[model samples]
Target: MKNIVIVGGGFAGLWAGLTAARELDLHGGAARITLVTKDEYLTVRPRLYEVFSEGLRAPLRPVLEPLGIQLQLGTVQDIDRQQRSVHLSVAGGESLALPYDRLIFTAGSEQRPLEIPGAAKFALNIDTFAAAQTFDRHLQDVLRAPDRPGRLTFIIVGGGFTGIELATEMRTRIRAHSDAATARKARIILIERGNVIGRHLGANPRPAIEAALREAQVEIYFGASVAQIERDAVRLTDDKHIDASTVVVTTGLRANPLVAQLGANTDDHGRVIVDEMLRVNGAHDIFAAGDAACAKADEQHAALMSCQHAIPMGKYAGYNAAHDVLGTPLRPYSQPNYVTCLDLGESGALFTVGWERKPEKSGAVGKQLKQTINTQWIYPPSGSRESILAAADLDGVWPPAV
Candidate 1:
């Protein structure tokens, strides 16, 4: 029996294991699959911007075990491609090595930390489940402190998708903890170095985003950068200071560091460059998906570091890896369709379609779709073998006609 080892337990890694197992079962090929991750639960990373809760993660054992895949909890320390092995540091400081005939890399991305002084020590981020919970606890602690100038203030650095969502919803999240008057008095501020908010989102969704920011009463500072993040305030590049109790940095994300260990060509974000088959270029018996691989979604576009691309990329990578091991023809990965649904808090959300991000829905209608995606679409089926495999179907459509 061949051994297939997968790294990470996020959306990409979980789906990759499931899809690979399904493919082997379909072909009646004998294989043993193991997934290495730091935790058993698959952290719903996309929803980390929202309130931290039990719903932010799904147990991987229930999903993987029923698919004839084993789950191993460990942090990957290194990938030895020459020896075809994965080195890991498990609980209690012990090292373990997993050898594989085929290795799938889906380690996912992490927040690109701001290099400014005090940014790392003071500013908080919601890049992981633990970080989000830490932010939540900090909020509770802040509520206990005596009301002061910057006590109820929140300054969100970067006006990108994550920053916007967190800024607009800051009041609502605060309301859940304190009185309505306290929530109403809360100040939410957004700072963007660029001239326009959501510039990365393109022009199509700009109007809606601007309208939503206005409705949310979010203070916007365009063409400005944070020179430093202090304990109780942020110093601007222009020497202006803004007082705030909470500061969040959402500059962007970088591909997982494991991508560099393979000695493969990488993109600007440190993502490994992969061919059409999701196979890592210049590496044998290795494949990558999600944020770890810089694969072309189409001739015109490369896949973004979002769960939208990660889910589908996982399926293709898993399928191709299985076929390569089985001596079958590999299928090229192609996902021409792209969509963006931006949640703008109480003002609702903006849904767009295509590479240009043309607006398709807005207001309450768009918010409904966004909620369904966060609450339903992104989660994998658990405790049911048939449902899990069906959801892993290679021919399935992304966003799944929802």
Candidate 2:
């Protein structure tokens, strides 16, 4: 039996492994599917800022085992396409060389730390489960600071999706755990390089975000950049300063750094340029999916580094890989639709659609949809093979434009 190795266990990698197994079963072909990652659990990364660590991770074995996919724990250091092998560093400092007939690259991205002084040591981020847990612990410890609301203030560095969600959510979470006076005086500050809040999200939904920020008492530093960061304060480019004991940098997002090792032509964000079939430019046996592959949404628009795109990309990559090995026809990948549901803590959410991002819903109903999408829809399917394969279909990935 041929071996198909999948690296990374994010949305893309998990779906690719499952979809490949489904295609094999459909074709009556026997191929070994193996998934290697640092952990066996799939962390619900988008929901990390909600401060609910208990439900953050979904087990992979319950979903992968029914499909005959094997799970291994390790961090991939390098991939040698010429030899069809991967150099991985397992836990406790051991090394392993795993060879495969075909490979799927789906390692996701992380917080792109800024070059500002003191950021590396003093900044906090919610990029991963471990990182979020660390921040949660730190937040808990700081709540006990004889300093009260001083150490309670949180400084978020960006106005993008993650940054906005974190800043808005911080208000409720911080207030819930503090005394009446501390809660009343609690502060959450967001710094953006643009003049308006949520400017990166475009004008369609920014007004709602700005209103939510005001209602939550979250401070905004518009048209300013953090020149330097210290343990207790941040200095802005305009020579202004804000004092805070907690700082988080949410500014940059490049593709997975591992994509650079493949030596393929990547755009400014380090995503491998791929054909309609999702195959990497310079490699024949290797395929890239999810955030790792810069696949086109249309002639002009490319897919973003999000679960909305990654799930379908993984489906195509898996199906194409299986079809290639089975000497069958491959399905061309295309995702012309897009939607976004931005969470705004207790204030509600904003749901937008299409390239122009027209608002479909806002306020409480939008918040309900956002909560369901984060807690139910994006999570892994159950242990049943039937359920896993049913949801792997690419066409039904995103809901109808609502």
Candidate 3:
């Protein structure tokens, strides 16, 4: 049997395992699949922001078991490309090596730490579920302190999606925290290096985002950069400083470093350069997807590092990898349509389609759509054998009808 081993349990890794399992199970000629992940659960990373506000999290075992996948809980320490084996450390600290006929590296991205002085030592991040939870606890702890200048001031670095969501949400979260005190007013500030906040989002719906931030009373600083992060304040490039008790950094994200370890072709962000079929260039029996891969979205541009691309890219990579081993014809990966729905907390959301920022919806209607996409659609189906298997089909396109 062809043993297929998949690393990582994020969106890409989970989908890859399911797709490969469905393909191999259908043929059953000679195929087996195993998934190795640092955690036993698949974190809904996109909704991690909601965890602070809504406290919602779903488990992965219920979703994977229905697909007949063997899950190995471990942290991958290194990859042995020549031997086609992965060295991993289990929860108990024991090391084990697992060999595979085909390997898919879907380890996702991590938060990019700032090089500014004291940023690493003091700043907080919302990259992972655990980190988000930690921040929530810290926020609660900050609320207990006496109301002072910096105590009620929360500063967020970066005016992108994550920063916007977090800043706006803090308006409501901090209010709740303040209600527990002597009615202290909280201040939230956002700092962006670009001339305009959400610059990459373009002009069509930029006004809506700005207006929403304004409505939330979330202060935004444009054309500004953080010079250094201090214990009780942040120094700006202009020498001005803001005293803040809570500081969150959401500047941008980069690809996982595992791709570089493979000595494969990679893009500027260190994402593995893959063909349209999602196969690693010049490497046999190896595939990559999600933030770890740089694949063509269409003839014009490469896929962006987002779950929107990762999910579909994973479906394609897993199916194509299994097909290659089964001698089946491969299908080229193509996703010409791209869309983004930015959640702006209580101020609502902005939805845009295509790379040019064509506005689709805004305000309350857009917020409802964003809620559905985040809360209902993005999560995996309950562990129903038939449904889970059906979801694994490579032909299936997510964001259906888009």
TM-score of each: 0.98, 0.96, 0.95
| Ranking, lDDT, top scorer first | 1, 2, 3
lDDT of 1 by residue, 49-145 (tens): 8867888988888889899899999999999999999999999999999999999999999999889999879989899989999898888888779
Residue-by-residue lDDT tens digits, candidate 2, 16-121: 9988988899889888999999898998888988965679889999999988899989999999878899899988899999998889999877778788889888
lDDT (0 to 1) per candidate: 0.89, 0.85, 0.82
Model 3 TM-score, 2 decimals: 0.95
Best by lDDT: 1
TM-score order, best first, reads 1, 2, 3
Give one digit per residue, the lDDT tens place, for model 3 in 1-402: 678889888888888888887887787745777889887776777776663753345677888887767889998888898999989999777999999988988988888888889887878988888888878787888888766668778888998888888877776676565573422367788989887877767788788888888888788888887888877788988888888888889988888877776779888778999888888898878899999999999989799878888888888888877888898877888899999888887878888988897878877888898888888777776657888989888877687653
**Clashes in model 2: which pairs?**
none
The residue pairs found clashing in candidate 3 are: none
Residue 336 CA error for candidate 3 (Å)?
1.3
